[model samples]
Target: MNHPATPQEQDYPLSAVPLEARKSLASMGLVLLGFTFFTATMWAGGSVGTAFDFQTMLLVLLIGNLLLGTYAAILAFIAARTGLNTALMSRFAFGQVGSKLSDFILGFTQIGWYAWGTATMAILLVKMTGLSQAWEMPLMVVFGFGFCISAFIGYRGLEWLSRFAVPAMIILIAVSMTIATNDGGGLAGLSAIVPSEDMSMAAAITLVFGTFVSGGTQATNWTRFARSGKAAVVATLAAFFIGNGLMTLVGAFGALVYQQADIVDILVAQGLATLGILMLFLNLWTTQDNTVYNFAVAGCNMFRTRRRKLVTVVGAGVGTLLAVLGMYEWLIPFLILLGTFIPPVGGVIMANYFVAWRARYPDLETASLPAFNLPGLAAYGLGSLAAYTSPWIAPVVGVVAAALAFALIHVATVAVKERRAEMMKPV
Candidate 1:
């Protein structure tokens, strides 16, 4: 396959980002923070908030986000070290052709997120403004395509939007939280509140972790541009651990105070409908662009093309159609699948890089790889199965199972080959 001789600025979808093109910690941190500040995460938080007391809910959010942050940070460090995103890294674990499986899985999940966000933005606009119900579908198409413009411009576009949006979002969140605390009767009233519903700790953690695990797996797209592994790790941890944790906190707080999980609804109840709508737009747009950009990167790897802009537009179109067809309702099941299947990809990639490649991959342009890597494929399958049936935290189970399976399979395969070679020697 012919790789591009000269890559476009900041988007090296088919190749590693060069050292000169790497970015600072604050740049990557802002972009990732924007991506993690999502509405669905709030919805997931709302679910957990209603299920437990405030103290227990805080514990669950902490544990769940810590797992997510650590997982993403590992991938981010590897990406920064290798200058390759998850899709490109998958080529080593899953092989050149087999990597398409990850491309599809990762790309499709991002499309789901894009569609959900698009549908959400349109639906809420209509609900809040008393626009005709008929306007929702048209609005979805308009917002869906509009959201991809930043993604089409690639990393630079994402950085510009995030710089403005992240701070504005933070301010909005702080305002909403202050109002919520006062309305809930402050610390005494909050502590006095009891759970109105029940959920297992495992399930609650899953809800928190599962909501963004897929996005975390693919965050390497931006993390690959980090100036160093330390920068990547710090930025990713801040985004997933703090940014995502804060989102869940807001949602849960809203749920506990007003029996509403969505931040927009919470704001509306607080008589900040104007600011809430603005927050909603900023929240979804930041994440929507990133999500579509992710799909474009995965598509580039899948199709072996450097036309990321073209692929981005196509991805938005597909997501828009899905939104019109009712993707908003699939949020729960989608998160569950993401939590179960996606972590194993990261697991296999970690094992492949650290164990097989010894923490260094050969230059992508010169490396010779097989069409398929059977050991990696088998390990992923086994890992996914372990996640499916395990009663513990499924995402964590999947990652560990897949990594162990890859190691054992590699060792066994090498031993058999060595024995066969010994048997064939002249005696």
Candidate 2:
């Protein structure tokens, strides 16, 4: 297994992982753990904790992460087998030009997240330093550019940042939990407490699952290097189930005990400022790098070019501008209103690989693809609609609906084509 990615290879995001370049499970696990362990996960957990009882929130997170892990694992397995990233794989189901739509979806969402995350860190940093509001814009620029430098360096930088940040996050959360527990009257008190507000079980599940569905859909960007399908599965499972779940627990713990959701804020409240600053930087930096890196991958694929570094710079500039303009508020409502749209992409890709194409992609060097794969596009639409209107689990419904719709449409359309050709034969 290739342990470290080549510098030249990381610069170009248009190609699939070569046969000799697959990586070991340990490497992939650590890399993804760095990504899955995020501040946003903890923030979502705070909302979860305030909405439900201790036991209920625990159950919701456990079930939600498992569901999230399942689809991510599917994408990871395909990536390991085909050595293609999600944006590239979308071409199989979405057609050559049509796949650009996927590129825009993935790229735009990541850019949105990048802007929101950078601004969030800036606001928090200003508050943490007790600085005046004037420092916020300066800090936002400083942090945004500083983080994009790592992204400009590409995957190696992300892996390095992840390796250190993942463990640091664990230590910070452990210490933060210990302080919060002692000051808030311990386990008995936490268990005895009630939710501050009412939240439906369905809504809680949606929040937990929807928070990361966009990123999870692009798991192949990180998992394409896995040495085998086993490596991909284990990496995805550990990252999603354990790393993600831990984030929620950390958030819930702080929110329930101290009414604070942001872990940095929780630590700062407990007089852990120095450590909070460190944890806060590492947490936001790793996520920002991953977000921007994925955005670059999508951008390069959309343009069918190898100039990912140029794309990286462009993406960072746009995201930084959006951040300064306060796009987070706009993204929040859009993210929820269109939450079901992203999950179907994973579903369509999975359906195309596992069922339609029999788990294999064509030669990346020369493959003639359709101009538009209507079956897949239609299936994605249906799946997203099901998610939006259904009373059941939205993400789950979206995935199943899209997968089934693609398979059915592909089979039926092929059969009709064959029959028409047979009837139109020279008689």
Candidate 3:
């Protein structure tokens, strides 16, 4: 691992964040809230909202977000204690050479998100304002690179943007929801709405959990800066559980009342088209930068470089190219893949930290790790298999399967070593 040479690289792509660099609870919370306040999440919520009655939708939201928050909070706690992000932590669980697998998977997902967001921003802007369709690609290129500006500057830039953007977005969402409730004739009206679409409870939970599980997996990037373990856990729960839940609720509300899942579309229908445009920009920008930032962090680990700013620019370009190539149309399938594959990485890391490492990872600078940790990789494979075959809560199944598999392997290996030692004694 190379030492970070610039202030921007102090995000420590290849190393642990030092104590002096840790951030306050508020800072971590705000940045995470910004990440969770995403448009896609609302779209996911809308899918659930249209399928179930209001009361059932709320129950599904609570269960799904609580599970997502718990998963993210556990990883955040490890990150804060170890001062390492998911990619860096993977070195211990996946081994020196094998960690790159996680790097590529995590990095690829973030780039996919970046491209989707870039395309979304461009397409939506053109449709909402009646711009010529020809301008969409050029706008994708522009916003693709533009959103990474703060990411290029690193954590300070992210925190600064979130400080302003999060509060503003929250206020806008609240205002929209209030208007929606009034138009729908309040609580009785909301309760009176019947399900218009058919979906199983399992599918609804999968939609809610799968929508952001990939992003949640990498949230350690921000939470790793927490000043304490408690700070990390609290901030993570607040963002994933409360902030994300609110986004889902807002989307569900809009879908039920206005028949529009996207808050932007709902706003436009409400004669707030101007504010809708503003909300779209802020909503996508907040998540776009964070997504690109996550890609850079994984890029640094994958390439073993400390130049995060360079990686950020390069990632934005790749994402832009993907957007131009039609990444926007791939959302549903992409999400299914994310739900099936991404959670196992987090599962392996949790098992590596608690069971294998006994809650302590050695300093990366001097640790003697193997080229590949066979058990971890095997566990990940088994976990992915379970997730793919499972009918209910695929993400949760993947996580538990991976963790349990790793622990089982650890026990078997220990027993083998003990047996060999016994046979060799006094011989």
Each prediction's Cα lDDT score? 0.92, 0.82, 0.90
Minimum summed lDDT over a 10-residue window in model 3 is located at 1-10
| Clashing residue pairs, backbone N/CA/C < 3 A, model 3 | none
lDDT tens per residue, model 3, 376-406: 9999999999999999999999999999999
Put down candidate 2 lDDT per residue, 125-205, tens digits, no spaces. Answer: 788888898987787787777788877887678778888998898998898889877876887887777888677888777
Superposed model 3: Cα runs more than 4 Å off:
1-5
TM-score of each: 0.97, 0.95, 0.97
lDDT of 1 at 131: 95
**Model 1, residue 336: what's the lDDT?**
90
Q: Each model's number of backbone clashes?
A: 0, 0, 0
By lDDT, the best candidate is 1
Spell out the clash pairs found in candidate 2.
Answer: none
C-alpha root-mean-square deviation, each candidate: 1.6, 2.5, 1.4
